[model samples]
Target chain A: MNVGLLDADVYGPSIPHLFGIKQKPDIADNNKINPILKAGVNLMSMGFLIDEGRPVIWRGPMLSKALFQMTYGVNWCFNDRELDILIIDTPPGTGDIHLTLATKYLIDGVIFVTTPQLLAVKDTIKSIEMFSELGIPIIGIVENMSYFLESTGLKKDVFGKNKTKLAELECLARIPLMESIAQAEYIDNSIFSLKDCFSELAFAVKTFIEN
Target chain B: MNVGLLDADVYGPSIPHLFGIKQKPDIADNNKINPILKAGVNLMSMGFLIDEGRPVIWRGPMLSKALFQMTYGVNWCFNDRELDILIIDTPPGTGDIHLTLATKYLIDGVIFVTTPQLLAVKDTIKSIEMFSELGIPIIGIVENMSYFLESTGLKKDVFGKNKTKLAELECLARIPLMESIAQAEYIDNSIFSLKDCFSELAFAVKTFIEN
Candidate 1:
């Protein structure tokens, strides 16, 4: 799949680390930058623009501009053909980054990631509500760190119950906390490693996209 | 102490839930919003402004305004005397909300809350970097959900090592996951309930502030 990922998380961009990219993207035509290609996906992040250890202490106005620049400023298309999918890694909250993206782009839907903790779940519900209010479609919810498996193979709900109205409201994927999954080694310049850790998740995502 | 709390987390204001305030704050003279007094501490939150179950779907600009209104627009003083201290409950991340507060206010210092997990620690590092760059002093770091205590009074580091250099960098307080702490009850508008959950934390904060 011709996938593209934009790390809209200007403050703490982790896409570069996730993709293991150190070199910056090249400047394409019209001062637009080309995204770094890894495996079968094109990735871009603000992490490439600034030095590591420097904080992006920008106010609201500045952040909005940067977010706009990152989205509309870059050259994300190729030869008049757009990417099959563009996944934006946004910071947690139901504010600026979300509102900006939802308003400025044609988002198909949004997937919410949350731990099973009540505090995290409560905030996520607010986030879901915000997205719905913005008229965005609820893609699904993924419960991360849902449970841990013991040596006896007994599944333990570490964070707490996945008892949320989210499952009733939409499709919910409960991703357990596995040591192997958490400690997955990324193969050199390959997406296979991610698939190993998220085989079930990838399958679910594929089903969602296909249907 | 004449303390004040502002729930700058407009999207999911949990101060109301945490403090268990059901009624709204009253509007004082010159359109200054009077904070709801609770156990000697004055509190204000967006949760008090809006109805339950509704989301604050505001853009960056609107959020800046709301944050400004919540901080400067409100009367955070008693009998013409300014509050001794005003604690702002910010959402996670170094995004618009953090930037807005950091830029607008002469914040003395910032306290970071994080789990011992690498993911949470990574984000907290970014937040710390942001605060440092903004010239906000690092008060200290509070490690929440640090451990799970067994029935036999054994403490297990479920998420693993408190591996961050935060202690070497700043004062660090590790808060254990205790049933008594979590299940602390809010009694008759008394903030003492929270003291049960955060007595050590409160003492650490007080020491940091005094120093």
Candidate 2:
């Protein structure tokens, strides 16, 4: 499947590091930018436009404009063929970026990811609720860092058992506390190791979309 | 000194819990809401306004409005006496909240608190840069969780050593990793233990302001 990834996390874009892509996307004559192709996936991020150390010191209007341009101005299609899926990674918060996306595009659904801590869970619920109010479908929640292993070989609930029960929504995936995932610099390669975990997530997403 | 803590992180307000306050702030007949006084420090947070489980689910305009109200509409003074200092704890990002605060107030300066991780330091720099552009003074960075003690009594940099070197900015405080700071729900009493650390921070602020 052809997938396009748009890193809308303007403050700290990680797509470049994850894919290990050094070069930025190509800009066309028509002002529509071409997304960089990496491992069969088309990727675009603000990391391409700005330097590594420089911050995008923009207010609400500029942020909204940047997000809008990233979504619409960037060509996601492959040789006139439309993209199968376009995944956008936004900064954590219900702000201008979300508002622009919600108002500008026909978003399919939103999947909330939260660490199994109450602090993180509370924030995730607020985000989910915001998306729901925007008339978007709630995909489900993915609980990360759910458990850790002790020297005795027994699993321990580090952030406590995530009893995340959203009415009418299911818990899509429970990604275990993998030290490898935390320690790794690149998520693209690290994600491959958690085959079963991602497989379950994929299945859950499919079910949610199909239903 | 009289200090007012504004929990501008509307999405996930932690000031109430950190202060262990149960009662909500009082609202006067003039529509000015009073901030809850705790341990001689007046505190205000969205945590007190809304139900614990219910989400705010607000858009950009609403979010901005709420933030503006929290800063302006709230009665942060005693008997018409102005507050000596007001410290705003914002969520991690450069979004509507930051913009609203920067534009609305003549902020003396900003102190950035970041973990020793490169990922976090990079983001903190971006935030500082943004604040500088907004004409707010960059009041140095506080490196939290800088290091931890090992079983063998060696100090190990878990998140890697923080190497922040801006030409004009200084590293204010290298807060050593303390489990007590992380685990404590109420920060009011807990802050008394870190008198030295905060004392240094206060001195830094004074120096930055004088210069």
Candidate 3:
């Protein structure tokens, strides 16, 4: 699949670090920024534009402008082949960036990620409600950090059990807390141990988008 | 100390849930909103103003406007006693709320909280630099969820080791991942198990402010 990943979290772009791509993108003849290709994915992020540890320090208008540039100013094509899908990773908030994306673009769906804790669940519900009100379909929720496996072969509810009933929204996956997933960037070529869970999630999302 | 907590995390106001306060603030005769008194602390948050589960759905301008109102329009005095300090719980990201607070207020210092993961540490450094550039003093860092204790009496680095060198700033505390802390709201009167860590943090902040 020809995939493009746009890291819209302007404040703290993690894509550059997560993908381990620090090289700046080049400008094409048409004046659109060319995304960096790595591991079969085309990627662009604010992290590539600034030095490490330098905050964007931008206001709402500037944030919206940056989002616009990232969305429309990037060439998501490679060798005359257009991207099949462009996944946008947004910052956690109901601010200008979200407003811009919701109003300006025709997003296929939004996947809400939340821990089992009430505080996190409450915030996730808020975002879900906002997107729903804006006529965006919520693909589903991903319950991350659901539990931890003890050495004695016991499952510990690290955060807590998933108690909140999410308005009948399907939970795509209940990903366990794993150090391997957290240190995926540090350990080079470390195969994700929980690939099965993620594959199931990807399949679910694909089915949702198709139908 | 007579304290006031301003939940500047307009997008996700967890203060209400954390503190277990649901009553809305009353408007004073002078048109200033009177903060809610809970456990002898004065509190104000956007959560109190909006219906539960409803997203703020505001743009940047509206965000800034609401922030201004919360800061200047709230009466932090209780029973003729003024608040000794106001701790603002800001949302993640180096955006308008942080900018507004840095530019408009006379902030003493900022205490950064991050897990031991590189991703979180990177973002924390961005925020630290932003506030430092804005001339706010560094009150050191709090490394929350540093480790989790297994039933086998072994400490697991769930996220990862604290690998990054965070300049010369002091690390106030290395708080463990405790289920008690996460479920503090749900289980009423459940005293925080890690009060010592927090007490030390409070002392450090106080000493820093005093000096």
Q: Considering every candidate listed, which one attains the maximal DockQ?
A: 3
* Residue lDDT tens for model 3, B70-141: 989998884589778899988877888889889988998898888888888888888988998889888898
DockQ-derived CAPRI band for the predicted complex in model 2:
acceptable
Under the 3 Å rule for N, CA and C atoms, how many clashes does model 1 have? 0
Q: List model 2 lDDT by residue over A69-114, tens digit each.
A: 8878998884576897788888776767777787778998888777
Where does model 2 exceed 4 Å of error? A79-81, A147-158, A163-169, A176-180, A188-191, B50-52, B57-64, B79-82, B145-158, B163-169, B173-211
**Best by TM-score, which number?**
3
Model 2 lDDT, residue A30, Cα: 74
Tell me, by lDDT, which candidate is best.
3
Model 2 pairs in collision: none
Decide which is better by lDDT, 2 or 3. 3
- lDDT digits (tens) for residues A63-151 of candidate 3: 88998899899888845788888999998878898989999999999998888887888898889889999998888988888888877
Predict model 1's lDDT versus the native. Answer: 0.72
lDDT (C-alpha) at residue B61 in model 2: 62
What TM-score would candidate 2 get against the native?
0.83
The Cα error of candidate 3 at residue B47, in Å, is: 0.8
- In order of appearance, the predictions have TM-scores of 0.83, 0.83, 0.96
Cα RMSD of predicted structure 3 = 1.6
lDDT tens per residue, model 1, A1-73: 6788889887777776666677988888789878888866878899889886466766556767887878777
